[model samples]
Structure formats: C-alpha cells, structure tokens
Target: MQIISALSEVSDRYPALFVDLWGCVHDGLKPLPGAVEALQAYRAGGGVVILVTNSPRPRAGVAAQIEDIGVPDDAYDNIATSGDSARVAMFDGAVGNKVWHLGPDHDAGFFDPPAILSNPTPIERVPLDQAEGIVCTGPFDPLADPSDLRPQFLAAKTRGLKLLCANPDIVVDRGERREWCAGALAKLYTEMGGESLYFGKPHPPIYDLARRRLAAIKEVSDAGILAIGDGPVTDASGAMGENLDLLFISGGLGAVETGTAPGGDPDPTKLNAYLAQTGVSPTYVIGTLR
Candidate 1:
C-alpha cells in the first residue's frame, strides 16, 4: 500500500467517495482535524461524497448529529446509515413483529419507518420474554461490557429468537473515551448461540444502500469509487469484499498500533506491520482525511 500525505493527491482520480463517518470524519464528539475541509474541497471539484456510517441513528438523525458536532452541510452530498438499512430489514420481517429493543433512548429514531417502503411490516417493542425477536442498536450503556448481557442473550437464544444488528461497529472513540457499540452485543449473542444479523460495514446490506445513494446522484463505476475509513475489519474488509479501492486512515482506530501521532502520518514500518497483521491491503494510506 502507498502512503500519501493528503487526500488531494488522489482525490481527482475518483468520481465519488464512500467515506466512513466516525473516526474518519469525527470522533463522535467533534469533526476530526482536516476532515471537513478535505470533504468540502473534494465536493468543490465536482466529486460526490457519501457519508457512509455505521451509526445506529437514521439518516436524518445522523445529519443532525454531525451538524451539531460542527460538520457542515456542504461537507458531503448524502448519507447512508446502518440504522436505516437495518430498519428496512426489521420492517421486512427479518426479525418477527414483536421485538425486544436493546439500546438507549437516543436510538429510538430507528423505529421511524423508511419512506421507501410502501408496505412495511408493523413492529412492536415488547418485553424480551414476550418478544419474537431482538433489535439491537447498541447497549443501554456504552460503558458497560457486552458480556454483561449474557443472561439476557441466553434467554433470547433459548427462545430461538433472531437479532437484527443495526451497527456492526464494535467500539468507537467518543472524544477521548472508547465505548462499546451494537456489534459487541451482536458478537456476544452469536457466540452464545443466538443468530445475529448485521446490516452495516463489512456486511452487504449497507454497501448496497450506499451504492444506491450514490447512484441517485451520479453513476460512478466501482473502479472510480473510493472507500475511506479506519476500521481494518469493517472498512478495509468491506471495501475489499466489494472490489473497490480503499484509502485506509491509519490514524483513526489503529493509531496506537500504527504509531501514528495526532494530526500526523503513521510510522511507515509500524503501519506496514499493522496492515500485515490485519491482512488488509488498502490502495492508499493517509494519516488523516486531509
């Protein structure tokens, strides 16, 4: 993989970019340094920017959250969130009608029906014991360990209920604190014999949704579309699986492992080792989005 200093070096080659939101564009609390400007600059030159996120929040909710965190409206052309993708599956009866919601209040927007579904199945949030399936947005407490849900998962597994995972991110750095995400719970559930369905990064559904969103604006071939993100398993694997070129941001989730300094490029030796260890081969590498 080639290590580049700025996105501008390769931005002109791609007609569109599927950029990951957290870690690439922001740290959950605020926009990452140089990320917003790079996106805006790309857009100014007639490129399409789709904010593809594993956030459990719906597209509208994500838009509001990013704007609140100082990412301007012009930073990208559109958004495709995992929550919306999972919601479509949930309402299509991937999970049964009565589902036990295992997440915090902020993620309630996930229940909002998508405008695209003409005859969406009605979903009812019932208690775990009475539900037919589970819909996991995330843990009720981001700080809590996913193992803490073992008892609850056991009960669900015993009943043979399927779990629909909204976001497939295991954890995210919320400013300075790392917090668990829905993927952790889904991992635990699958480990405990409960079937877990994912609709986010490293999975097909979210990528399909992102492609549709991109096609709505402009028709860019897979060869001309670049995927940018930090997660080796999620971002890198997803891009590779889809046969799209990837620009891995070594300074995000793998900063420490790659020996990347804040707002700086990663040490080339460490970055190579980290990539080798993860078995991910991105087309390019950058310290930050800039």
Candidate 2:
C-alpha cells in the first residue's frame, strides 16, 4: 500500500480524486506550487477531481476563500465542506436553540446565526456558558489555541451542553505554521465527558454525500476514485472506513511530528507508523502534489 511514484504517475492511474483542500492543496495562505499544475494536468488527462474539506464554512464560502488565497476554482470538479452537511440539521433546528460561537465568523455564518459573536478572540467567557452548546471552528491563535481550553470545556460539560465540531481536522497549515483545529479541542472535550457531534470525513455521511455528487460521471465508482489528504484519522482513516483508495502526504500534518524537516516530505517509516495506528495504509505516498 505504501508505494512511491512521481505525482504524475499517480494522477495517470486515478482519473477522479477527492482532494483535501487546506493541507493538501494550500496552506490557508497560498496554494502549494505545482498543485494547480498537477490538477490542471489531471483535468487535461480527462479526469475529474473534487476537493473535499472539513472546513466549517459553506462550500461557496470555502471556495471563495481558497480562490482568494490563489487556488483556482479549476483545481477541482466540485467542493464539499462539513458545513454543507451540518447545516441540514442546523436549519431543521436539531440543536434547536442558538449556538454559542467559539471559532471564526465564516464558521458561525455556516449556521447563518441571526446573531454572532463579533469578537473573534479572547474566547468570551460569560456568554459562552450561556449558549446551548459550543461549535468550535478553530483556535483563534495556536499558541493559545482551544487546546489550552481543556479545563474550560469541562466546565461547559458540567452545564450539560453539546459541542458540535464543525471542522474535524486536528491541525492545519496557516502558511508555514501548523495550528490546532476544532477536532483536537473536540477530542479533549470528549475525554472530559462533554458530548460532541462531528460532520466531516473519515465519517460516513460526508463521504456518502461526496460520492453521490459524483454520480454524473459514468465511469467514476468503486476503485476508480481516490481520496487524498494529510491526516491519519480524518483523511486516511475516513477513506479507509469507506473502502476507498487514498494518498497520504508527509508534507502536511505529519511533517514535524514524524521528525521530517520543514518544507520537506515525510519518510516512509513514520508514514507506515501512522498507517499502522490508523489501520489504513494509502495506495500512494506523495510528499506533495508537485
């Protein structure tokens, strides 16, 4: 399962791909070099590629932000975000009452909350305890990210409220720096006896919806589709649960924890260790799309 091929060779085999946007395609600040070119070539080869991200923003909102960051819309055939799935339940008022905001404004807008916490940082103390549940988008700052709020989340748990993790990625690249994500906070909250609901991949509904969106393509099914991402749990594990082929990158989340140098791809040993833990080894190992 751990094979190395030039990026182009991998593209040749799989005509359709479900690519993770943030870490795999861009770093939330700019597109990775040759990522655009790789996708362009993939498309040029008569392939279809869709970007599937766990960003809590709506697909349109996410796509816009990526475009602003210089990732062309042509990079993928279509896009899906966790917000796209969670909104169905949100609109139905599943959680019913208003949610206390904890992340970014775009994330809050996913619920299209009539009212939002205008203040982004300082992780409001009083009103946060007042809301029905907490929906975490990300840590405002990594140094003081929500990971530092393990105790605070426990206090919220005492009040008997749910925690909805909009973006389930544990970490993401903010340009050259890797920061904590909502899922990492959610995991801590779970360990602290707080309840949570996640609507992102490595989870079933998200992948189901993504595949259904690709039904128009006659030949894309079963072994033909590939899911590419950086994380073991979200990207690799989720794809594993779905019985889909995957491409794992050492350049993204695994870059440092596995002892790889900055801007360099990960080695196969650490990657194998990651897969061994996740129980999902990918078909390909790409340092980057380039």
Candidate 3:
C-alpha cells in the first residue's frame, strides 16, 4: 500500500466517496483530529461524499450522535447505516417484526421511533423465546467480552430464531479500549447453528443502498468511486465485495500490529504484512484520514 499524507493526492480521481464512520472519522465520541477537515476539503473539491457506517441505529440517529459529538454538518452529503438497511429489509418482509432486541436500551431509537410512527413493519421487542426473530444492535454491555453473550446466543439458537445483525463490526475502538459489537455476538450465534443476517459494511445490501444514492446524484460507475475506511475486515472486505478502490486508514486496528514511527507514520514492513495476511490489499494507505 502506498502511504499518502493527504487525501487531496487522489480525491480528485473519484467523483464519489464512501467513507467509514467510527474509526475513520471519529472514535465514537469525538471526531478524529483533522478527519472532519479532510472530508470538508474533499467536498470542497467537488467530490460527492456519503458516510457509510456500521452503526446499529438508523441514519437519523447516527447523524444526531455525530453532530452531538462535534462532527461538522458539511463533512458529507448523505449518511447510510446498518440500521437503515435493516429497516428496509424488515419493511420488505424479509425479516419478521416480532424481534427480541439483543442490545442495550440506549439503542431504543433503532426500534422505538418506527414503532411510534407506525411503519409498515414496526418492530416490537419481545422476550427471547417469544421472538420470531432477533435484532442485535450491539452488546448489552460494550465493555463486556463476546463470551458473556454465549448463553444468550445458545438460548436463541436452540429456539431456532434468526438474528439480524445491525452492525457487522466485530469491535470498535472507544479511545483506549476495544468494545465488542453486534457482529461478534452474531458470529457466536452462527457458530451455534443459528442463521444470521448482517446489514453493515462488508455486506451487499448497505453497499447497494449507498451506490443507489450515489447514482442518484451523478452518473453511476463503480470505477469512479473510492471507499475510505480503517477496518480490514469491514472496509477492505466491503470494497472488495463491490470491486471499488479502497483507501485504508492505517491508524486503527492496523496500527496495533503495524507500529508507528515517532512521526506516527506506519511501519512499511509491518503494514504490508498485515494487509497481506488479511488478503485484502488497499489502493492506498494513510496514517489517518487527513
């Protein structure tokens, strides 16, 4: 991967950009340094920016959180989240409405608003065994390990209930810690013989949604779009799935193995091996979004 100091190096090459949220733009609570400005700069240069995220909440909820967390409104043109795609699938009757919510109450925005608004397939959170399906926004406790959800997964599996994983991210960096996400729990459930439906990055539905939005604004062409993100599992895989070019952020999980120099640039040898091990090579790599 070629290390780049500024997105301006290649921002003009793509008319559309699919940007990641959590690790790439912010660390859940605050905007990553210079990340927001990089996005604004890209937009100023005439690129259409769409925020693609694995957030379990709907796009409006995610937008509210980002704004609350100090992300400027002009960073991107539109937003897409796993919850938005999951809601679309649910409304289409691909997944049933009587779902047992597997995450915390803070994620109520994912289901409650739709229920009040009387969406066609408004979701109802029932007890475990009473559920026709499960909507996993995240873990009940972000600080807890995935092992803590084993019993829950086993119980749901034995009942033969399907899971709709709103966030397909295994984990995300919350400043100094790595917190378990819905995808980790869904992986455990699948291993216990339960079926799971994923809605976020590395999945086709979310990408299709973003592509459609991008198409609406300009001539649709995969060759002219670039995917910028931090996770190899989610972002790299998603870009590969859609055959889009990727610009990997090397300061997230990629930084753990590929230690940085004094100036915070990635160690070339380690970064190369990390990408090689994942078998997902990026078109470019940068220490941060800026």
Candidate 4:
C-alpha cells in the first residue's frame, strides 16, 4: 500500500484512470474536497479519467445525478454504471428475447424509450418460458437474508432462464442501511443451477467498453489506466477483475480498519488480506483521494 498525498504521484504512474463514484468521489449528495480537484488536475495533465460506478441507475441517469451533486462534468472523460450495462444486456438479443422482472418497482421507468420487454413488468415466468431471459434488478426483499430469494431463483432456473444481474453488488450501503442487491439473487441462483451474467464492475465486458469510451475522447491504453475506488469488494474487485492497476481508497465502503490516522483510517494489512483472498491486488492503497 502506497500512501500518497499528491496527485502528481498518481499521474506519474498512470495516465488514464477509472475512478469510482459514491464512496470514493462523493457521498450520494456531496463531493469530497480534494476528490474533484484531484480529478480536475488529473485531466489537466493529459490524462483521461472515467467515472466507472456501480450505480443502480443507467449511465446517463447516474451521470446526471453526479452533476446534480456537483462533480463537474469536465472532471472526467465519461461515465459508465452497472445500470447502463444492464440496458445493453436487456436489449441484446443474444441474452434472450422475452424477459421477467425481479427487482424494485422504481426501475420500471428504465425499460421504456427502448422496449426491453414486450410485456409490462412483473412478467410471469409462465409467459416468459419462450421469451428472452430474466432481468434481476434487486432482491425480492432487501431486508431478508441473501438466501431468501432461493425459491424464485429455482423456479426461474427450472424454466431455463438466462439471468442478467443489473446490480453486481450483493449488498450495498444506502447511508446506514446494508441492503441486499440483485447480485445476491444472482449468486444464489447461480448456486442453484442458474447462470448469472453481471453487468457492472469486476466484469471485463463493461471494463473494456469503458476503456473504449475513454479512448474515444483521448489516447488511452490498459497499462496507463489506474482504478481508484473505496471498497475492496465492488470497486477494487471490479478493477482487479479486469486486471487493471488499482488504488484502493479506505474510507468508502465501510469503515474497514484503516490504520489509525487522523481524517482517515485504513488498515493496509486488511487490504492485503482481502487482495490475497480475492486473487486481486491493488497497485496502490491510499487513505483517501487526497
């Protein structure tokens, strides 16, 4: 874990970056002090930066929300979210022709403007037997355990459904609540003989697409890309999953034991352990974006 306080250190090592939102850049509503400035500086130095996030909403919607929260649009080259990837899989014919919805009701609006499913949501499996596939947005019960959705998952599998997980996160922190996400359902379904294709971080397809997006705006390559994120699981895993150099921010996901430091506390030892366990190690580990 390399402790860096200056943006120059980051730019010298990696010219193109994939930065995570939420825990790494801002909370839901506010941007951190140096985060935006660091990003601004990174861009000024001939580097291309992309805000790659696990946001449940589509890429455009998530970008709008970030702009609303004050992360200057000029700070990065592009934005990609899990929801955006989900849109691709939802519409991609290879995935399936008909679909079944297994997520929150708020997500209904995403299906419009581009007809994802011919039938209105809460689409029955019986009708979907010959349809495209399954679209999982969230857990049937966010409050229930990860195993709670086992029954429906089995039914979906029995129907020979191809699963598309909109949110690759099994659990996410919404302020203080640890809510189960579509990833949990996907994992369970996979265990019960259902194959789940995830659309967010740690998945190579999305990573490659994000890189191409950056390339479109600026000259970029894999070696020059550095992924900075707050969580060892989603953000870190996403970067590592794609075999990119990574910087793990300690304060984002949970107050994981950061070595006792003022303004920030990140336990480098814990990070090492997580990296070893996941078979993915970050190139750098910092307490915060600063």
Measured by TM-score, the strongest candidate is 1
Candidate lDDT values, in order: 0.94, 0.74, 0.85, 0.72
| TM-score of structure candidate 2 | 0.86
C-alpha TM-scores of all predictions: 0.99, 0.86, 0.94, 0.84
Q: Which lDDT tens digits does candidate 4 get at residues 102-154?
A: 77777775454334346433332324445558878886678888777666667
lDDT of 3 at 39: 91
Candidate 2 Cα misplacement greater than 4 A, ranges: 113-126, 145-147, 150-152, 216-219, 257-266
**Candidate 3 CA-lDDT value:** 0.85
> Which candidate order results from sorting by TM-score in descending order?
1, 3, 2, 4
Q: Candidate 3 — worst ten consecutive residues by lDDT sum?
A: 112-121
The predicted structure with the larger TM-score, 3 or 4, is: 3
lDDT of 3 by residue, 248-269 (tens): 9888767777775322778888
Whole-model lDDT, model 2: 0.74
Best prediction by lDDT: 1
Each model's total of backbone clashes: 0, 1, 0, 11
lDDT score of residue 219 within candidate 4: 78
Off by over 4 Å in 4: 113-132, 259-262
